[model samples]
Target: MTARALRRRAPEPTGSGRGWKEQTRRVSELCLLGIVATVLCLPVLTVGAVVATLSTVVAHWIDHDDLPPLRDMGAEFVRRLAPGAVASAAGGLATLVVVRQVQWLASGAVPGGSPVLVALLAAAAVLLTVVLLAVPRLAGGGTWRTAVTGGWHALLGRPAAGGAALGVTLVAGLLAVLLPGTVLLLPALLVLALHAVHRALVPGAP
Candidate 1:
């Protein structure tokens, strides 16, 4: 063979190249899932189920390094419907109570508007962090009790990471409140942030 021919290298296998392609595909899948999740979440009662499914998809991707079929997610969603809806309803009710309390205080019906607002915001941050952890636990095959208690453990064990996740949620919430249109982006951002937090905080989490 000529020197030039000898110098040429054979094409490499596509396995590694496929990784980036795989990641890109996963990202697109996440976005699409987020879109579906956003629509499902509109009813509000399905919020917990949607969040759980989002976390399940994320965990599945992390653990298996593959995209689960949409049908699998759909099946899981169906299975989780009852519990998820119940949880969502409870959470919504609690949130409504908080909102009403906050409004009452702000309207001068009570003595401590500023203090109440600050306290409520802090409470919300903590609650949001717990819920984020809980959903992923459920997605990972944990029961409701495990989801709740494990969430607290995860949050306490990794305060910094938990705080960061809560912070992202808060900022996104504020932006949604202010711009309204930015609410459209909240689902994708929340899922991505919570997935990152789960990877960091959940032992054996994928």
Candidate 2:
């Protein structure tokens, strides 16, 4: 065969290929990561660490355009466990307080009634948004203290990005509540959404 004919017959390099197959592969990887992270979080206390590790993995994927080995996630989870526990405890306490307050307000035990309840709900939403934005910082190898602080600053610095991330999370929560089955994929989707929002908004973020 002629050189031109051989060249035309040669398959395109795998690395350079793009289309639905590549998109499907990426989605499948995220689903696997989500399932694995959810399983790791079954202990409850490890939820924070699992999220942080997943965030790191997703960030790595975003930077490199490929997922890392699954085994590496386990090592990252262990390394993050201590600080993640602290974050989890703090987050849990805060959630408990908010829930209690919401319950009390909803029962009409408070003076302002609906207005007060609305304000409280808004505050809780803002707090959750800040925490969502901070998950990526946890993977930056910082202490829980630093991650929380950085997350607050990041939200303040980029309110639009924070709002976008919060919207993504709320949508995910709604889907989980409505579909139930989607809970299996929620973890990875949340991490990916947060990272994508940050990468798209913040200048030079990976």
Candidate 3:
């Protein structure tokens, strides 16, 4: 299909009261097949394209009927993609470190012989946390360095809430797909369920 066809947002759904919910349902239904198809054929699509598409998906979930088409969103993502990407990569790295630390602490282990390891890890964590600041500015304007200071404050402001949300998302995303026997399809079902929840509250999200 053409890019336009591929990126078409779902029509406004039938409902009342919750404009955002209805919008979410509509977009979810609209993109369900395409998303499934893409996920199935993930090897065929470039990771960059998938990342761009997912960014559009995220934006769509946040904004409903008025959100721009996926094509335009993709183009927009291409224009200023570094900030969010860097933030995301850095965040992922941080998550890894946090997880590893938790594992270490849980193991009842003490400091290792590699004394420099702790220092290096601490420095990396500091840098990683700093990168989050640029994520907001990456949506439009802001220097990569400035994002560090701004992000530090935002991080402080929303620690608990962000932690809870991240915890839930990680759990749900992990359970989104399960494989038992030849195919149980439980994980995919879970993903759909999570998507349902996402659609309900997320604007224009699909």
Query: What TM-score, computed on C-alpha atoms, does each candidate reach?
Result: 0.79, 0.88, 0.42
**Backbone clash pairs in model 2 (N, Cα, C under 3 Å; residues 3+ apart or in different chains), count:** 0
How much is the lDDT of residue 19 in candidate 3? 80
lDDT (10s digit) by residue, model 1, range 52-106:
7777777776667665887998898887778888888889998998888888878
Which regions of candidate 2 fall more than 4 Å away from where they truly are?
1-17
- Which residue pairs come into collision in candidate 1? none
Error of 1 at 109 (Å): 0.6
State the displacement of the C-alpha of residue 40, model 2, in Å, after optimal TM-score superposition: 1.6
Predicted candidate 3 versus true structure: per-residue lDDT over 60-164, tens digit per residue:
434453445657755754554554456446556667876776567556574553454566566655554333222332222344456456545544664542333
The top-ranked prediction according to lDDT is 2
TM-score of 1: 0.79
The per-residue C-alpha lDDT of model 3 at residue 175 equals 52
Task: Name the candidate, 1 or 3, with the larger TM-score value.
Answer: 1
Q: Kindly report which residue stretches of model 3 are placed more than 4 angstroms away from their true locations once superposed.
A: 1-57, 81-151, 177-206
Per-residue lDDT over 1-206 for candidate 2, one digit per residue giving the tens place of the 0 to 100 score: 89999999988856447677897898888888888888888877887888888888888787777887768876888998887787788888888999999888888786779988999999988888777777777665656677667777778888998889888988999999999988998888788888888778755465
lDDT of 3 at 86: 60
Q: How big is the positional error of residue 144 in model 1, measured in Å on the Cα after superposition?
A: 3.6
